[model samples]
Target: MQDEPILKVVNLKKQYGPGCQWCSNGHESIFEKNRCLRCGTVYACNDLSFELYPGEILGVVGESGSGKSTMMKCLYFDEEVTSGAAYIGTYDDGETNVFQQSSQQKRHIRNTILGMVYQNPVLGLKMDFSSIGNIAEKMIAAGDRHVERMENRSKELLTHVHIPLARIKDEPKKFSGGMQQRVQIAKALSNQPPILLLDEVTTGLDLSVQASVLDLIKTIQQKFGISMIVVSHDLAVIRMLADRTIVMLDGKIIEQGLTDQILENPQHAYTQQLVYSLI
Candidate 1:
């Protein structure tokens, strides 16, 4: 384990507005007029803190509505953090003012310092662009504006993802689901980021495909020395990848421990239920 952390999320909170699917606010009893933005009611994920060390894999797990996705949004700074600080490095640098940063600053951070793999590969890719172009887009954002750098980086990334160099010119529509996701992985790594966030990266794939993608992720994490946060409901995936596991419920962390410890001796009742079902 590295002594320094690559990403630190501290006391983080996210709330969605009324009409949102994930809202955790009070039942529609009081009927306040000015609800939060987006969903329209408060989808509160309050006061969560977690860290990811270099070359370490931290898994976030829970049932639906457990705030796993909410927490991820906060980490990536997608939804404005209503409060608290999420530091990308030097966990104690006291840079708690993410909202105050300009849009350019946020873009630079998201582009150069972090890589994220979404649950859906297609939604994250450009339907009009070829595979190589999609990966090169990341290079452009990260300041590798020259065409040669973009081309070289794209080819290298596709190679890293085990995609044939010939397929790099093809549209995503031409690839299998697993191959498309591997492209997503390649694009995420285009900037050579030290931190990667995988949110349900294997969702909708068959067991064999899931295993292959999992293996690819493990290989990349080892090769790059990047810190990773794996968020998934798949317990088997968590067991295989996570150095430590955090289990959430109703927008709060209910349990955390070594993956083995929690799997073998779950403390919280809900955690026990999760474990038994895995049996």
Candidate 2:
């Protein structure tokens, strides 16, 4: 069925500070309340679980410090998970938890199964590298050796992301913020990974630039049928890209459903506030 999940996560949590009796005994939402009054531990992310279906865009919406980005970090393996399991359907028949894999296996998963675009171009792209070289770098990490093939693929991806072929030789630092983000997108997709992780890709761009990048993302998803988990504080971005949406508060998912449903009829109080604030 088209609805089958391609990626699954369960009971994911990430915490800062050592666990103490107070941290364990507290009942308040860490995100809403800021910190555990007794233990001083902060829950950057807590008890996150979700499924991303094949060819579907899943949006995660929350305020800053709500652990949305931390969740993405966990999924991308950029940050260590405190405790949880994530499975990619294509990996070992979905039997192995990605968090439990060795560093080498994690690298393979990052290169071959998952692609991520960070909110900051500096975080995702090598600003000093030419656009073509940036994409080629990813290809090289994925075991690509044919220089000509990598170049061709880079050109095609650049065109897809609406960066001109003429600009392919330019370093990202020479481009506009939007253009730099586009280069990042092209680089992420260079290996044709099955799943993509986009973290606030439009955060710092002008409104028009943001729209264009969002459009490019939609087009790419349609063209490649890739599953994606898009993280952002902007409801507009989520509306434009996600079929299903999850509302996270403090480090936990409070509500989730179809994008229209979450926007139109949010059930959780936090979600209602988030939805209404956009009006």
Candidate 3:
């Protein structure tokens, strides 16, 4: 791994409501999990900090309300963060904080620097558009104007993700869950982004399909050397793909280290419960 991080997120926070005196003063005793009992403010993500090294897969494991998805949304710009900064090494030499960028600049970053695959295929793919058309849409968003080139690129990416040539022009709504996820992967890769964010991409799939999707993700990482942050509640999934792991609970990261080390010797109680449950 490179010494310099490909992506760095510092003290990132996302909250749902205005804080009251008890929560605003940094009093943890009055809060219920991540919420202020007195004010009903939900701290969806609290002071999250992490880094993604070049060509490395960073796994973020947490339960349903653990803020993993919230953090992913903040990173992908799907939702605005309440505070904190993220620096992309490829963007402005890692000198600019992406959260502070203008809407146009954020769009540029989303289109060219980062690719996101949501847990829901509906969020990533245009269900009515042809699979190839969906890929082309991302390309066009990134300023690609050549029709033939976009078409070729779309075909190449779709094929790479195992989509049948015959179905390349079919709508994603017609595909199986696995196939839809594959199409979403193809669309995400159309811009050849250096950083990919996967938020529970394999959740709700059959075991065989989940394994196929996981294998494809590993293959993509190997082939493209992309740095990825994969968020999932499944420790088994994390063990298969991640080099390093971060364990989150109630909007905070309680433990993090090498995936193997964390699995073998989890330091936090919650992490231990998670690892032991997988046995």
* Best of the candidates, lDDT: 3
Which pairs, if any, clash in model 3? none
Cα miss at 194, model 2 (Å)?
0.8
Question: lDDT of all predictions, in order shown?
Answer: 0.80, 0.90, 0.96
Candidate 1 has its poorest 10 consecutive residues by lDDT at 29-38
Q: What digit string (tens of lDDT, one per residue) describes model 1 on residues 108-195?
A: 8788877888888776688569999999888887778789878988998888888999888998888888998999999989888888
Q: How close is candidate 2 to the true structure, as a TM-score?
A: 0.97
* TM value for model 3: 0.99
Off by over 4 Å in 3: none
Candidate numbers, best lDDT first, in rank order: 3, 2, 1
TM-score for each predicted model, relative to the true structure: 0.88, 0.97, 0.99
For candidate 1, give the lDDT: 0.80
- Model 2, 28-140: lDDT tens digits are 54423546866678888888888999999999999998899989988988999999999889999888998999999999999989999999999888888999999999999
Q: Write the per-residue lDDT of candidate 3 for residues 1-279, one digit (tens) a residue.
A: 999999999999999999988898879899889999999999999999999999999999999999999999899899999999999999999999999999999999999999999999999999999999999999999999999999999999989999999999999999999999999998999999999999999999999999999999999999999999999999999999999999999999999999999999999999999999999
Q: lDDT winner between 1 and 3, please give it.
A: 3
Structure candidate 2, residue pairs in collision: none
- Between candidates 1 and 2, the one scoring higher on lDDT is 2
Misplaced by over 4 Å in model 2 are 29-34
